[model samples]
Target: MSSIKNILYFQAGLGVLANMFLLLFYIFIILGHRTKPTDLISCQLTFVHIIMVLTGGDILFTDLFELLNIENDFRCKTIFYISRVMRGLSICTTCLLSVFQAVTISPSTSLLAKFKQKLKKYKVYVFLCIWSFNLSFSTNRIFYVGGFTNVSETNHMRVTKSCSLLPMNYIIRGLIFTISTSRDVFLVGVMLTTSAYMVITMFRYQRQCKYLYSISHLREPPEKRATQTILLLVSFFVIMYWLDFIISFTSDMLWMYDPVILTFQKFMMYAYPTITPLVQITSDNRIIIMLKNLKANHHQGLF
Candidate 1:
């Protein structure tokens, strides 16, 4: 069982490393070339990805120490707090990204069209808001975590090192869970609705073009590529998130000690990040073109 747990930890570590590399490539190679200023979604996503990578690295280290029976209280507390914050940030970033894409793809005739221009101007502010919101919730984890301590009343357990929460603190935990869950649901709904609307609009546009009958009159709509990209992103987010949610819900019911539950949770959390890069590599033509251009440039420089 311990060996199995170690294998799971290693797999999670690999996933985090893969995500970190892909995110770095996107930032420095892809986004770096854009003439326009970086937007809220881009900046926030990059920061969140970096945090996830670092937090996962810490968790990997902690797991190794546990296997070796090494008790480092400070390291354990730092790991616990950082990992919780990173996981929370991951969910928050995903929610924000979904909403941003949905609004970006909304029809000009729709009420959300006003947001399009504002996003161009207020991108930095939006990112700041996301950071602030996550930071507020994350501070609670720092206080609640503590080092592992054994009490005579109960068997020895590895407690986090830091200020511990009392029974009264359950209220705060409940509030955090409620707020986070509601935010996720709202974002998911927006993504689904926006994607569906885009699909219907595309079909209507195609039908109209077919009826026009003049080849010269037929042109692909300006939003066609953008809509396709957003739809792909939404689909990927929903599938990965649902799997993670299922594993998490089951783990809570079965308890983390259950081998099956622990295995599934580790896979769900770590493996989900790997799918993002694979999706981008397969679907994002812009990224492919950028990579090809870079390679060509390298070869020219060598000559």
Candidate 2:
């Protein structure tokens, strides 16, 4: 238990710091008028990850609620609601990122190429719609979650030390479950489809590149590298998302959470968000170049 807690603490802290740094970098680019089409989605995703980490009470220690004298019901409701909304946004943004990248690298004569301009033009509206839908969809959480008052009540599933899910009507619960599951399935389907399309497209593009240039002269384009990174990020998200979903579904169905199992679930849930920023930083040439320039300036000044 102690070792698990320590790992959670380390993961949480590292995730928060990495995400914050990435978020600021995106903001700087936007403010400096050097924003790429993908920057908006990346910025939103990074912000969502930051909130996801903070609301992960298990990771950061929910004891702060007691120290801060927050009302138990309000605290539970706020934390659960925000966490759910951010989780929804995380998937939505990731899916959008994948789709946009797919269109980005499509051949000029291909069907998907037509949407590139429109997607860029309407992306803000798309983001607004996504946010509005998720915010409304997750509102039910405000009513169904509260401070854990009765462990003896078998219907209440304790999610955190202070928060538990209140039992709803069977029909309502089933309805919500079906709807949420369907939404997730649709998004995951889109992600996988885009991923497959990207893979095929990259393979063909590489073949063409090979024909055009000698092996020694061939170099990867920035766009291709970005696509590869998004592919990797999406693949990681899908794996982590399903693992967490299965654990949560089982626990919800049984209306019981084993401490170890719950901890494991939280680990799976946090894994993608924790690793996302690191993947972006390492794969993004812009960030790497900026870092190198800053290091050079520092060294020159010190000398």
Candidate 3:
């Protein structure tokens, strides 16, 4: 189990590094001076990517210290606190992304559509709320996660840093978990529901287009490209997240020590953020055009 956890840390480290580079590229290259909807999403996602990178780095360092049997109390506590905060932020940001995308694609008839007008204007406020919510929820861990002097004999001594959850801590942890889990369920439900609506809407539009085309008319106004992009994102989330959830739940139930399961869980968790920039770049024409222009200029200078 310890070795398995170490392997997970290594994989997460690599994923975080990739995400960090991608985040920088998106901020400096892809989204330069753009105030578009997709650009805003990219910026938010990059912030999450930075948080994940920091969390992954802390996890890697913690594992390394454990491997070397370092017994520093303050270092252990700091790592524990930082890791908890970062992990909480990652999960919260993912839920935020899902909700934001769903609201972005909602039709004028949908209740969430009203927020579209306000989204751009109050984007900073919304983000500040998200940060505050996560920070407040995770603050309890600071008091609970002190380094322990000895590990229980029953469970394997994975790391000497041995921080045990206090009995009272469980209540707070449960509350945080419940809130976070509810948020995840809500976001996933919204994504699934919105995607289904989008598919149905697209189908209806296609039928309308076909009817017009039968009379030698053009196709239906080029179909909303943003809708298609949101659908793709929701699909990716459902597939990756469902698999991770299942593997994690099964592992916990079976008390399994399989490294493969750990690997898959780590991969699913980190891979989404790391590849998000590529997904956005491919799906958004504006970003692609910008990249092309930059490349053209670079080539022109070379010549």
TM-score of each: 0.72, 0.96, 0.70
lDDT of each: 0.59, 0.89, 0.61
> Tens digit of lDDT per residue, candidate 2, span 1-303?
778778888888899999999999999999999988799999999999998998884445356766788888887888889889999999999999999999999999999999999999999999999999999999987998888767675668888877888888889989999999999999999999999999999999888888888867877788889999999999999998888888889988888888888888888767899999999999999999999999999999999
Better of 1 and 3 by lDDT: 3
Task: Find the candidate with the highest lDDT and give its number.
Answer: 2
TM-score of 2: 0.96
List the pairs of residues colliding in candidate 3. Answer: none
- Cα shift from native, residue 210, model 3 (Å): 3.5
Candidate 3 TM-score versus the reference? 0.70
User: Can you tell me which runs of candidate 2 are displaced by over 4 Å?
Assistant: 57-61
Better of 1 and 2 by lDDT: 2
Pairs clashing within candidate 2 = none
The local lDDT score (0 to 100) that residue 7 gets in candidate 1 is 69
Residue-wise lDDT of candidate 3 within 1-303, one digit each (tens)?
Answer: 678667656666655665565566556744466444555555666666656644443355666667887875656666656655565555555555555655665667888899877877787787788778766766765665456554454332212234443334446646755776677677678667767766776677677677666735653232366667666766776787678667745653454435455555555666665566556656667657777999999999999
Q: How many clashes show up in model 1?
A: 7
Q: Residues 115-180, candidate 1, lDDT per residue (tens digit)?
A: 878876776686667667766766765554555444333332222222122232447756866776
Over the full model, what C-alpha lDDT does candidate 1 score relative to the true structure?
Answer: 0.59
Give me the runs in candidate 1 sitting further than 4 Å from their true place: 1-21, 29-40, 61-71, 147-173, 212-226, 250-256, 294-303
